[model samples]
Target: MRKRYAAQNLLFISAAVVLFAITSCKKDRTTTNNNTPVTATPTKLGLYEEAQTDNDTVYREVFITVTQIGTLTVPDSLSDQVFDTGSGGMVIDAHYILPANMITSTGFNFTGDSTVVDGITITNQKHIIQYGDDNNSTATVSGNLCYASVTIGVTNGNIVVKRLPFYMYYKSVDNNGKALPPHEFDVFGANSGYDVTFPNNAFITSPFSYFDPGTGLTKGFKMAALGTANFSDQNEVPLTPDVITLGLTADDLSSASGFSMSQLTESPPYGYQPYIPATITYNGTIVNDASILFDTGTNADNYLEDPSLNSRNAVVLPTNAAVSVSTTSGFKYAYTVGKLDNLTYVENPQYSGVPVSIFSLNFFFDNEYMLDFTDHKLGVKSN
Candidate 1:
């Protein structure tokens, strides 16, 4: 996902707080395998009478000030302060309060200093936080507290406090028809784990690898290129024309053979139209194409949007109950349960459901992939 900003309707702390609650809470925490606690449950505190009274006083004073000053205004005097003034004097600030009884299922910890986490580096000034892909899906944020503080180097850079946003894009790979582990991404940085390389060309981004379920041969795929163009904060960006392409190759096409390199196409026949291809599967007997787009982020197991096709029988799934399938990447996707309509043998009928199963990112796991901007293709390879 990429971030977009509005010049006039700039994001502020208050707006960010509201947007955070809406977008973050909308995600069903049950889908993530990571142990990070998503939300905290409230509990009654057995505080002493004196402590309660003190808390009440503090709350009243803060509330009154907030109401009077308005949440959007920043004190001019405070804005002039420098980074060395200490953590409390930054341009923006946000507070995260965990529920009293909250317990993390998977331990959450930071491994980097304040200068960077994931891949974004925050300066001492205020920055606008935006979220989403080319589609209209997005969230905006402003203020100082958008990120967490991580300690940097010593001397003038000893303790660096950064603003950490809650959302980021995650990338993964699927070989043949299996899903692989996902790789964490920074969304806006160069070293975001995406690598593009060719055996005869200089290595760039990482590549994801896997064995084709159809042929039982090891293969690799990676990103060929990526870029952003023609989008605005007020408009919804469609997923075609300006799109991402992937490059793929395998050692061999036969289950009993060794290996080889070949070009693979994954996009739907619509040529990167509004419909997003989400999943592909080969059940030893049949292969199905399940494509769909959902609001969930990288944690989504199967984010596909398309119909299904039977590889063995060369048939398509019935159009009754949309078949929900899972990939090796642990992503779950649903294919349209309807049969192909208006069968035409013409070269290109604008849109045709040849029952050809198309696969998306939901198929790879623990493998590195690349988006080649120069060639307009995606590449994948295994570690």
Candidate 2:
């Protein structure tokens, strides 16, 4: 009798211990983790963080900062130094763009038990912050409903991420469609395994007033082909005409099939830019397989063409003569250069190897640029 009684008590104690362990785990999972606070720093931009939901579903969140034209009260974290001012005398700094390579969920690690994740979309936004368009510009940043580890890479040694307040124009809400607070970047402190180091300081000067002293022009602004400055997004219509209708490239496209090499190039996009094939023809001179830097960062219409050309003055591309850019999927982007004769013939870009041409900010007015990663295709849409 004594032996039987002892065995019963032992069984009860073991059961109790198991129950306690299970309960403790439940508490750990349900409650907000103190060690993993939502307010952590050093966020990994492309990784998604788990955000709360109303039901059994768990949703992920990511933060995106766009360059918008308006009264942007620079966050103290980013206002480290005075960048520049807008045409309206607003404090200006270069705009922050999500790393083109890091913004997708191509290699995201899923933690849940289920293999399928319920993806949600939030629409009817009053604006698209990218182009500062309030209406008509229907832009969708698509991917695997990327799980934003809610990580913001605010600092990395000497490279500090100074950004204007993140404007989530198209996706300012959570996967569950919850509106996110402005500048609500989620980074998991130092433990986040990712460290972002940019080749250049994106926020050095105001995107609106970013003056490339090398070329010598000003205005992080809406400029006419003749070179005028205007920065007013009031009433959803800024002076900078929303020229190109941008689209997020599909997820399955990549460079493996000789489509686009952007994903395989470098850690950053600006450093690598978009690599494409082109033929620049001027004054009856045609150079095929030409090297060109199709940069959207440049704001002026007059760009830096290869200085090797004979005509020092701006070469007038005869009417009906368009610079043809060969793109992935057999798409061709043509920039009809008949409009203006303001190109400044300068020394070829110091970029190693070949002489190159640049398609700057003004180029957007004439053509649509597409940088698709997962889909592995880069295309140019001629307007």
Candidate 3:
């Protein structure tokens, strides 16, 4: 029997159990290979929805890409199997056919029957889908897969499987170590990819009305991080609704990976929030000129550390300030963050928590943005 788990309201984190702040930060939008488009046509797309985990409630969507391995026939009925995007849907436990050319990391375990023919490797793998707006959101897939010989794709390229029965195993504790009941729901799958571009003034013209079916949560796109960081330690505990975090410290940035501490920052604490060349604006005001890590996975909420240092103020605007953000590509977007939302902040011992002085914003799919891994750029969609 599956261990039943009770769902908890985890839309936002509790102030008492402060874990870590997750944000994705990238360098200023730079068009590499000058004059080339930075967006990739998404291979697949599915409607976004919210799910409840033991620790939190998350917005999730799944994308699938099926390629022919040899001569195996994938049922034509596969495309008809899509999951509902309703609030009550269950978390998906779907499988993926590992591509022969794909290089997987140590994060996954392979299982079940496997066969290789014609220099093609066929294996079943499990991939957990999350509501993500980044280019590398679905890069890592985990699970023990079971399958037989497969065929290589000849005609069908991508398929969006919707409204299907999907089950996920979950267990929770009532602040004590007690087991919870099992749950189930339906899910959909499809080939997932992002085709985004950040042309000038894109943020000003994009849509911001996003309604969360699970909690009736509505939000608009307001700000974006110039860069992002997940964790200093790759093996750190994962957030319930896993997200792409902003990269802090000198080591987090790919461009400054080889720099020494002395070459990174010249602060009293040295390396305490190694600088990032970024900026932030609130209601047309340049409140922050550097060190702001915009988080899209959360909400339009803002945080201000009590008794913040002058340097901290230089990078993040106070919660009392009018709320909004403008992008360098010439796009102006606004949001609403209440004045009472200020967090009685404290620094993190792990150097992993959202810094008391650092600012975090939520704008996942609130406004369309194209994430291009090929060019290492996050382009705000201006259509």
- Output the TM-score of candidate 1: 0.21
lDDT of the structure predicted as candidate 3: 0.25
Task: Report the error of model 3 at residue 350, Å.
Answer: 7.0
lDDT of 3 by residue, 1-383 (tens): 00010111112111121111111121233345775433322121222122323233222322121232223333432322222211111232222323333323332233443344333322332222222112112111122221222221124332212111122212222323333232121122110111011112010001011111111111111112222232122222222121211112212223433211112222321111112333444435454443422232222234332222343222334455565444443445455544443222322212212322233323333443322221233334222
TM-scores for candidates 1 onward, in order: 0.21, 0.33, 0.31
Instruction: Give per-residue CA lDDT, model 2, range 56-124, as digits (tens).
Output: 422222112222222233353433221111101111122232323322222223333212222211111
Query: In order, what lDDT does every prediction score?
Result: 0.23, 0.26, 0.25
Enumerate clash totals for all models, in the order shown: 75, 31, 45
Best by lDDT: 2
Residue 31 lDDT, candidate 1, scale 0-100? 26
Identify the runs in model 2 with alpha carbons over 4 angstroms from their true place: 1-264, 267-272, 302-322, 327-329, 336-355, 373-377
Model 1 lDDT, full chain set: 0.23
Output the lDDT of residue 245, model 2.
Answer: 16
1-383 per-residue lDDT for model 1 (tens digits): 22221222333221112111111111223323676533321111110000012322210000000100111232332111111100011122221122222212211122222244334332222223443321233443332222332221222212122322322112222223232232212221211121211122211111111112112112222321121122222222222121211112232223222221122232321111111233443222222333322211122112222233212222333334344444333434444332332111111111232222222222222233332222233223332
| Native RMSD of candidate 3 (Å) | 18.1
Poorly placed runs, candidate 1 (over 4 Å): 1-125, 132-139, 143-296, 301-369, 374-376, 379-383
Q: Evaluate residue 298 in candidate 2 and report its C-alpha lDDT on the 0 to 100 scale.
A: 29
